[model samples]
Target chain A: AQRVTQPEKLLSVFKGAPVELKCNYSYSGSPELFWYVQYSRQRLQLLLRHISRESIKGFTADLNKGETSFHLKKPFAQEEDSAMYYCALRDPYSGAGSYQLTFGKGTKLSVIP
Target chain B: DTAVSQTPKYLVTQMGNDKSIKCEQNLGHDTMYWYKQDSKKFLKIMFSYNNKELIINETVPNRFSPKSPDKAHLNLHINSLELGDSAVYFCASSQETENTEAFFGQGTRLTVV
Candidate 1:
């Protein structure tokens, strides 16, 4: 079974500090990885996807197949960036063409000013 | 306008009570899904429907039933809810394509006393 593992339960960092949230996945076939963010009292939204190869709000994640990791990174974290981050993986080979995502335990990011 | 929406943002009911959560998406996506977030913030896929067809049904309890009257709405009904079923339920939608990302609604926090 495909699984996503996010090792950190909570991470605290000072404003303007670089931030990296670790994510690792276990899947046999090629995997599509994504990062979703949930702000305080807000709905979850897509932050970025590996297939897009784009950065949203200064966050970028590179897919490392050898390491089975897709770590979200930011050059300088802001207080506004404080939110819960979840890593998800979609198995393309899962039959019926259903969009089922296996999500990791979210990491609560606390940015201290 | 809200792209995806779920009714009754907070629901508190006694155990063994029957409850239902309604979801609607204006994004006109072809796929809708139900996900559960446990107390520890672990998100897991519960069920998925594409064009009102059940495509992915995870190892959820039989008490949990998903109904999609159309492509734009997917509602979840729980019968004989237990304390263990208390969690945040999220409704999401996505296009039936490999590269499309899922858009999520504000979750329904269901508390079974």
Candidate 2:
């Protein structure tokens, strides 16, 4: 079974400091990876996808096939960056002829000003 | 207009009662999905429909039924709701293919007393 793992239950960082939220996955084949974020009292939103290779809100995630990871990173954390982050892995279910996203438990990020 | 929307954002019901959550997507996507977020913030896919066809059904119990009347609507109905069924349910839509990004709706927070 494909699974996404976010080892950090909570990460506290100072504002303007670098931030990295770890994410790893277990899959048999190439996976489509994504980072979803949820701010307090807000709905979940898509942060970025590996295939897009586009950074959103100054955050970037690089897919490392060798490490089976797609960690989200930012040069300087901002107060707005404090939120719950979820890593997801999409697998193609040939039997169903569709794709399914498996999400991690999520990590809460706190940026102190 | 919201791209994806779920009715009754907050639902509080008693155990053993039946409840339903409706979802609609105006994105014109060919696929829709139902996901459950437990109290621990762990997300898991419950059901998926592609072009009105049941594409992926995870290990969800039979008590849960998903109905996709059209390509733009997917609703979830739960029978004999249990205390363990209290969680936020999210509806999402995406292009019915690989490497596609999903658009999530504001989740419906279900509280089973």
Candidate 3:
């Protein structure tokens, strides 16, 4: 079974400070990792994916297979960047039996002004 | 237009009553999912459907049933709603293949009284 673990329940960082949200996963096969964000009153949306290897809204995540982690990073956190972030892993070999994701308990990030 | 949409964005209902949340995606994706976000913002997958067929059914209670009429629509029907059922339900869609990101809806907040 593939499981995602987000150790932090709440993270606080001052504006302009660097931010890192930790995410670790357990999977036996190749896994696809994703970062999803939900801003206040907004819909939860995809922030980025490990396969894309692109930065969105100044946030980037690197999939460290050895560490089994995909930590989201932002060089300088902004007040508007405060939101709930969730790490999700999809099983590549679930086949017709399963295509669901194992999501981590999200981290609530607060960028203090 | 929204890529994914869920109806009754805010549902306030009494316990023991039955209710349904509707979800539709305009992105032409083949896979859809229903996720429950609890009070602490922890997300858990309840169901997944591909082309109107069940793919993943988590260890959720049998009272919670998901029905997909087609590839574009997936609805959730809850029987005998409990206080534990109160949460934000999000609908998402994505390509069946790997390397694709799932797009989520704004979410339906179901409040059981």
Candidate 4:
């Protein structure tokens, strides 16, 4: 079984404040983790992946294997950072039974000015 | 031009009706997927196809069927739709390897009246 858990339904923070959205997963096999963001009136897009270890739009997420977590963080929240963020994990194998993804319920981040 | 596109940006229908949503990707990717976002904004993978072959079906109901005529297109058809089926449906695609950040199309908002 594979699952992703996002404990926070909503996270509101003032501009310039740091923000963190927590995610946890349970997968039997090696996993590929991703963070996706959907802004107002915009299509859902990939923010970053754990494999890439890259930061985009001032946001970064660290995958903590010990804690079984992949929490997204930003040092300074901007008004434009408001969006729905989803954490997902894909089975690494390409075979018929293992190529799909399991996604978290998602957290809505509101950056208040 | 849009890299990925899904037809019927909005659909309103009564329960028990049948309908289909078409998706196409112009990115020449070998993998395509259909995802359902519920009212609470949880996105779940319903189906995945690789190179026109069914690769993943995430315990979706038999009423929901996905067809892939080619590597670039995947369509979903639902039978005996229920009010529970009302949600936002998204189409996505990605390359098989290197560049695996999936690209999503503008979602189709389906409302069961």
Candidate 5:
């Protein structure tokens, strides 16, 4: 079965410091990856996807096929960056009419000012 | 208007009680899903419905049931809820074709006492 693993349960960083949240996946075939964020008292929302190859909120995640990783990174961590972040893998069975997502235990990022 | 919505943001009930969480999506997406987030912050897929038909049902317990009256509404009815069933339930929707992004509703927090 395909699985996503986020190794960090909590990460605290000073404001303006670089932040990196590690994510690794186990899959036999090409996998689609995404990063979702949930701020305090807000719903979980999509932050970015590997397929889009676009940066959102100064965060970017690159799919590394060799390493089987899609870690989220930001050059400068802001107070607003503190949130629960989840790394998800799209189901391989999603061919045409299916949409299934498997998510990892989230990493709580705390940006201290 | 909210693209995806779920009723009763907070539900507190006792064990062995029956409860239902309602969800509706206005995005016109063909696929809807229910996810459970435990205290450890692990998010897992429980059920999925596409066009009012069950497509993906994870290894969730039989006490948990999902109902979709129409394409845009997917409700979860849990019978004989256990103490372990306490978690935040999230509803999400995505376009069934060529779409990897999913929009999630504000989650319903279920607390089984």
Candidate 6:
């Protein structure tokens, strides 16, 4: 079974500090990883995807197939960056073959100004 | 305009009552999904539909049925809801192609007392 693991339940960082939210996955085939963010009282939205290899809102994640990790990182955290972050993995080989996404227990990020 | 939207941002109902949450997406994506966020903030896929066809149905109870009337709308109906069903339900849509990000709706908070 494909699984996504986000170890931290909560993370606090001061404004301008670096932030790293760890994510690991257990999947056999080539994986597609994504980071989704949900702000307070707002809908969840896609922050970035590993396959794109492009940074969004100063956040970037690299897929490490050997380690089975795709950690989200930002050089400078802002107060507005505080939100719930979820790491998801797409399973293309499910019984339905619909490419369902398996998300991790989200990590709440608190940026103190 | 909201790309993906779910009705009844908050729902409070009795344990035995039945309720339905409606979702619609104007993104014109081919795939739509229902995800549940538990008390621990763990997100999991409950169902997936592509072009109004059932594609992925997770190990959810039969009481939980997803109906997609058209390509743009997917509704989730829960029968004899239990207290354990108290959680936030999200509606999301995405293109079936690779590297495309899924768009999500502001979740519906369902409290089954």
> Each candidate's TM vs. the true structure?
0.96, 0.95, 0.96, 0.94, 0.96, 0.95
lDDT of 6 by residue, B6-66 (tens): 9999999999999999999999988899999998888888988885358645479999998
With candidate 6 superimposed using the best TM-score fit, by how many Å does residue B87's alpha carbon deviate from the native?
Answer: 0.7
Interface root-mean-square deviation, each candidate: 1.6, 1.9, 1.9, 2.5, 2.0, 2.1
Clashing pairs for model 2 are none
**How many pairs of residues in model 6 come into backbone collision?**
0
Q: On residues A1-113, what C-alpha lDDT tens digit does candidate 6 reach at each position?
A: 78899999999999999999999999999888899999999988999999899999999999999999999999999999999999999876553437678899999999999
TM-score winner between candidates 5 and 6: 5
lDDT of 6: 0.91
Q: Which candidate is the best by lDDT?
A: 1
The worst-scoring run of ten residues by lDDT in candidate 5 chain A lies at: A91-100
Give DockQ per model, in order.
Answer: 0.72, 0.64, 0.67, 0.59, 0.67, 0.65
In terms of TM-score, the best-performing candidate is 1
- The true-versus-predicted C-alpha distance at residue B71 of model 2, in Å, is 1.5
lDDT by residue (tens digit), candidate 2, A10-105: 999999999999999999988889999999988888899999999899999999999999999999999999999999988865545256688999
Better of 1 and 4 by DockQ: 1
**lDDT value, residue B1 of candidate 4:** 96
Question: Model 4 chain B — which ten-residue stretch has the worst lDDT?
Answer: B50-59
Give per-residue lDDT, candidate 4, residue B96: 65
Candidate 6 interface RMSD, angstroms, 1 decimal: 2.1
Candidate 4: tens digits of C-alpha lDDT, residues B50-87 = 85467546478899998887778899999999999999
Off by over 4 Å in 2: A93-97, B55-58
What's the true lDDT of residue B75 in model 4?
94
C-alpha positional error of residue B23 in candidate 3 after TM-score superposition, expressed in Å: 0.9
The CAPRI classification for model 5 reads as medium
Cα distance off (Å), candidate 2, residue B35? 0.4
Task: Give lDDT tens digits, candidate 1, residues A1-113.
Answer: 88899999999999999999999999998988899999998989999999999989999999999999999999999999999999999987665537788899999999999
| TM-score winner between candidates 2 and 4 | 2
